[model samples]
Target: MFSSDILEATVTIIPLWDSVAYITMKAVILDGEWDPRPEYECSETEADTHKSNNGSQTWKHPALHIENREKPTPESDEVLVKVRYTGVCGSDISMTHADGDRYMHYSAYVNLPNVIGHEFSGEVVETGEDVQSFSKGDLVTSEVTSYCGRCHMCRNGFNGHCENFEQLGFTIPGAFAEYVAVPEILLWDVSPLEKAYKSKDDILKAAATIEPTTITYNGLFGRAEGIRPGDYYAFHGVGPIGLTGMNVARAAGAGAVIAFEPSDERRDLARELGFEYVFNPVETDPTQAVAQVTDGMGVDVHVETAGAVAQTYPAIDETLAETANVVHISNAGEPASVDLRQYQANAAQVYGAEGHTGDRIFTGVIRLMAAGKLDNLPLVTSIFDLEEADTAIEQASKRVDGKVLIEV
Candidate 1:
């Protein structure tokens, strides 16, 4: 048996031989206005099971239990948020997969048996004494990385590479529960952007998408030499991030935007979203198709959102304009073999664009949404109650073309 308590939250794990463990917890509801319940209990067996609609096993993570544990109290520089909506991300799927062993990569940071959601929107329910920027009831979404400002990387303006970075949903307890305590520095107030959001539902959708949209914005604007008018743009995937990238590129006045997706559902969605050039890589060579469309000039910029290194590397190399840039934003866990001479011959630049620059990208994304340049509501193809989070993750990991949200 393994039992530990940190900051009033207790995790009890009963070992069942070498391969499995049984976990359970009891938590209290903090907000007096919502539910005054003092305690609720949850067990690993009661958690959502990973079975698809077709009766096939789709998840690798063995246990995804929800606990009703003691509510977290924000530290002096933190605030407690009442989570409203949380978006399912590819990283979440990878972390929860059983056969992938992906979580091992972050085992040094993440604590097991923790809540697991990073992309979320919520209202501030309480604040610690030193919290200054936000008050209770404020609608906000926060950057997921909790960086130590004192780190060398943070001092040098590369907070994303902070030497002591603690990522939500990875290194600590996340927003999958009814409430989460977050550092005030990571919070972004979305109240000012309400004018662009028509209703509560619309705002929720925007909040759920802020994280991914900001990542896309960071890649297009912060990493690459921002999109220029009349430039040709190409995307190698049509997932949520890819869709957001395409929308951002179009809004910036790209001359032409093309996408290559293997999923029929995604292809249809790209067309429906007004993309004039959407092709299935299975049907045609993406490099050849892009070359023909650009009249042999190739694309001015290429974004790789699909995590397939083997496919994206060649596609980007073969379809890059002579002096163009390739933004490698995907998290392809494995290494890829690429012809270095192709890059040298073309003089094309390859940038490893990852997370956003926190609030800077979030504010910019909100401004774009306000100006009617970006709208991701259409990308929310599926929504589930918070209780169905496991199912939501399962659906998101499928061949779906859009976003899946959990209403918390």
Candidate 2:
């Protein structure tokens, strides 16, 4: 009966029973709520256990190190992943800095010093006795959330909104470290990596890109469900997500995918990735550019992936067609004003898209990688070790480069 909410990245845990706990971030249930709580604070023995086995490492929190004295034992349905590589995203940066009091209190209570990376790949070092679908030593990537299968949202296959969802990096400790225990249902056998990829580096790069690509896939193809072949598509903000949208739009049969990126480096990358055309919103009016590109007709589908509030309405103004379908997938913090009357009169449809819940989008990206249709390796420009997590976070915040990978 417990439910938790991670509002604005703040983690709050509410106990519905003495043993059961809920993570508010995604409304996931922790079934062993009745488990007894240890009343003791960090003991010397407990503190001693925190040191790395190598014993020569100087540790900070990974960002802020609060000791998690308890190591969770895997349940019968879980498998333990010996994490290898993890990728950081913009949201992780936001949470790390607590850009606002926004969700600070909640996150403090729940996600503090959370093993923070979500986009990751690993090997199954152990499997629960009851885990029938996988075995130890299997290569895999986790989908980042666990959901109650029987819930209304899950029954509808929108498990991302599972009334009780356990998000890996937030609700549960994630794969930022050497290991993470996840349910068997959330594990995918990525062995035969060669069967699905041309090289280990390629697969690792795909692993980094899949999470962001899935966001775009879920946003464009998932939300604007009717997007069909030959639809004109435009995406604002050619960051990782926007660039991924370029590939997705093309693959989905969009005649052309115009990427608007203010960053010259990103724009160059987008052009290199086969985006038919790329523009710098800073130098020219993207709307005007799109109009010219489309022969004065706005695009049929418009996606706003730039996490900037100021650019949103402008992007909307530029891309929406007479009967446009626009999906807002960015997580901009402030409220935005829109002229509903204009949208209504133009016969436009707008939908808000969020994170992925299951492996559908994840698998989809993997399949794309396997086919060599999506190039993710180019997107990964830097790599760092787990100990340099703080530096990685700092670099990611700058967004001056491409995706950053952490070797766990």
- Among the numbered candidates, top TM-score falls to 1
> Which whole-number lDDT from 0 to 100 does residue 147 have in model 1?
89
Model 2 spans > 4 angstroms off: 1-63, 66-73, 100-110, 150-152, 191-196
- What does the lDDT read for residue 176 in candidate 1? 79
Tell me how far the alpha carbon of residue 365 in candidate 2 is from the true structure, in angstroms, after superposition.
Answer: 2.1
The sequence of per-residue lDDT tens digits that candidate 2 reaches over residues 1-408 is 333444523333433442232111111111111111143243353244331111112122223442323345578999877677788777567555532322221121123335666788877777788999888767788776688899999999887777666678765777666667899887766654466677665665566567778888887766776787887888888776787778877777787788777888888888776666788887878778888888878888888888675766766764677888888988775687776776887788888998765646767766776666776677777888776777887788776666788876
Best by lDDT: 1
Residue-pair clash count for candidate 1: 7
Model 1 C-alpha lDDT per residue in residues 1-408, reported as the tens digit of each score:
444454235323433442222122221111101111123232232223211111012222335765556677789999999888898887666555544431122212333456778899999999999999999889888898888999889999988888777777665678877788999999988875677877876886787788998887888888887457989999988898999889888888888999999999988888888999999987999878997889989888898898888887887877778878888888776798777787888888888898986546888887888777787888888998877887887898895748898887
